[model samples]
Target: MDHPASSRAGVIVSAPGRRASLRLSYANAAAWGLGNGLVSSTLVIYLGLELGAKNTALAAALILSAPQFLGLLRFSAPALIDRLADRKTFCVGCYAASALLLLLLPWAAAPGRLATPERSLVAMVAIWSLYHLLEYLGTVTLWSWLADLVPGRIRGAFIGHRERWLLVGTIVGMVATGIGTYLWRSHIENSATWNPGDRWLGYAAYALLGALAMLAATIPLMRMATVTTTASRPADHVRRRLAELLAPLGDARYWHLLLFGCTIAFFNGLTQSIQFLYPAAVLGLSLFAMLTLRSTMRLGQIAISPTMGRLADRFGNRPVMIACQAIVATGPAFYLLATSQAPWFVAGAWLAWIAYAGLNVCLPNLMIKLATPHLRAAYIAAYFAITGLTYGLATVVGGWLVDTFRDERFYAFGTTQIWGIYDLMFFLGWIGRTGSVVLLFMVIEPGAKPLSQLLRGEPQDATK
Candidate 1:
């Protein structure tokens, strides 16, 4: 004898429930960002310097490819969540798994314990792959779970608020990691009591602490389950659920959006291959300087997210996306110009961050908007899978290109010069991204206002 209200779809109708959910969401995002920031900035430094992975291309390929490759498995999440019939349990499991996997990563890279150098590298990659797989799983499930909780009309404001707090966590985490690493390095260098050969022990210690923080962050998410609705509807049969996975591919509109997303992912993978190496290898910047530069980028995101969100709500996600693509197209060229100077690279990071923040906010919102409520999870999965496969391969290709021309340099007119490997990458990436901007015009969001109306700053009164 279920009540009619209880049989209806799960939606938070009361102000108190929504407020409680929002608070928990903010707390979870901040804690998760803090954990990520602490370890993310350290990965490249620890691998390339501490582990003596001097083959830049190999290191970059391994680091960037893991996530993209594993992201394809996101297709399984929706079906799995349906079968399990509990998004909260699945998400918490992922969070716990990520913490354990991250803590276990350092052990795989332990220098002398391995039989050979090659074996150590292999072990590191395998461990990191597991860690990234869990990370993506957690992200995919969490997004779907949270999307169900948010009321449609207020989604823009809520996402903006969450992103702001997330950036704050990231800023604080970056500063702590940077300053902490610098001091640790200094202590090891100066202390007669410390062994130089054991410097990697410091990375392991920090990773353990970060892992603990990741687990601690789940407290908020767990508490939120009691106050919020984590399930959308009942599960379907395996065959029926499997058939629904193809629905996104069948829908012309969803297909176009997926293509648009995949295009961006391809170009991003190209640039991400060198994101860490270009600054570190070319400019010889230290960990502290790199993290400081990243913190500046986060500061920009924090400042711009609110405006971007409101604009998306007012105009449309399509226009915001177009503007973001235009800005993103300029990023690689900016990096090309940064060949010899730290300030040039800093400027590039700032510009890229601002553009990326807008895209980050709008793209997901648009995807959710386009998707039918029952199939939203599957739609998100399809988007990630298509993009992930293409992006993963592109990343490996970028790595190969860099390795081919690492020692080669091209001299220009008079005293002007360029590092051959990175220069080619930046220039080519610029061309690809610039060309991709045209695809946005082809995407038709049915609910979005016309481009002319958006340009005129007219609100779409029709948008629900």
Candidate 2:
């Protein structure tokens, strides 16, 4: 029988065992990120440009936002894990199933495979939704599992380390996609003998690779050791389970974090569709250029993630998050400068997005820190559900606004063509983002030092 080793926090695993498990976890994150970067990063462009999706704005928004919408299914993770009593099995099973489902996306979108482009889009959406549902369930369980596996003291560093590898993998995958798509568009698509019906073949090849990468991710996860969950007493009854699920809401600190999360999610999502649509449709950026921009952002994340994690560890997650949020809110301003003649100006926007690395590392750390150890899964589920739904709704609303104003132009002083729908959306998004900082202020991170002190080189509190 395997006995639990002692640790200050989280499930006890011996030092050597914990180190080995974390190494495997890092590998899993890298492989998973590679798959995500290949498929999720390129799907919108593939749909709009290759698959001929109609209602471009709404379709792009739906494609981008659908996964978050399906994040509602994450709420089922806790109970399912409890019933299964094996998070590793649940996570592996979900990931494997999702990968298998993802393999059908190319078939669903292939021309002549479905009767019409509309039908193809519908099929793609259905497949994508189901894929994300399973992926989200797996993600929730994985986070819960990691919450117990990684000790609190090093949680920030561990997240940052894993994220760095994940970003590295994403960067590699995106670079490959850029190169492949560039070659395809230049040689294959423009070739005299190329068939219009086969436009999706290039994208389909990448999708296949992405699916395989996702399946490969499961291998590392399988090697990681399982730890006992903190859910001491099982809630067998429906009422008890429901109550347990709802318990996170009763915690004031977690509630504040939830509000901050919802606010950020909404603001960040407000221009989701146009972010892709404007570049591809209006500015005429190639898939290669867009992927390059995304890779640039990931590279930035790779550079800053470790520093952010250290800051969070020394000061607190909130201080780092606050600073990062402020920087990220400035991103839309950069987008506002990009015009058809100066599309490269959008590079600044991508650079500004680098700040998200801090939030990505810190936010989850804070969430797990605030949650009750035994109920971490429930708290995580609630966080994802509420924030994901908010983001999806915001994206849909933004899409509607874009569709409604696609033909109209707005003037600032009645003499200048000051704004198009995309511009308007970007400005509004920036405003919402700037305003959302207020919610961040409302969040209470225990044992956190003030940002000013951290900047002043003051020693961190020993107890923290």
lDDT of 2 by residue, 9-102 (tens): 4465666676788999999999988998788645544654566757778877787778788888888898898787588999999999999999
lDDT of all the models against the reference?
0.74, 0.82
Determine the C-alpha RMSD for candidate 1 after optimal superposition of all C-alphas: 3.5
**Model 1 spans > 4 angstroms off:** 1-14, 41-45, 192-195, 226-236, 340-346, 409-419, 461-464
Model 1, residue 192: distance off in Å is 4.1
Candidate 2, residue 5: how far the Cα is off, in Å: 2.0
Candidate 1 structure quality by residue, lDDT tens digits, 1-464: 21222211354335555467679989988987787777773454455356665576657776777667877888888878766747778888888888887877678667876886567766776767777777777777777776767666667767777888788887887788778877887899899887776777766666667777788888888877432443454355776687768878888888777777888788878877687777777766667777887888888888988788887777777888888888878878878777554446546745575777788788777777877766777877888778988888888888887887788888643456545878778778888888888989888775777778777878754244
List TM-scores for all candidates, in order: 0.91, 0.95
* Model 2: CA > 4 A from native: 1-4, 7-10, 229-231, 234-236, 413-417, 450-464
The local lDDT score (0 to 100) that residue 396 gets in candidate 2 is 87
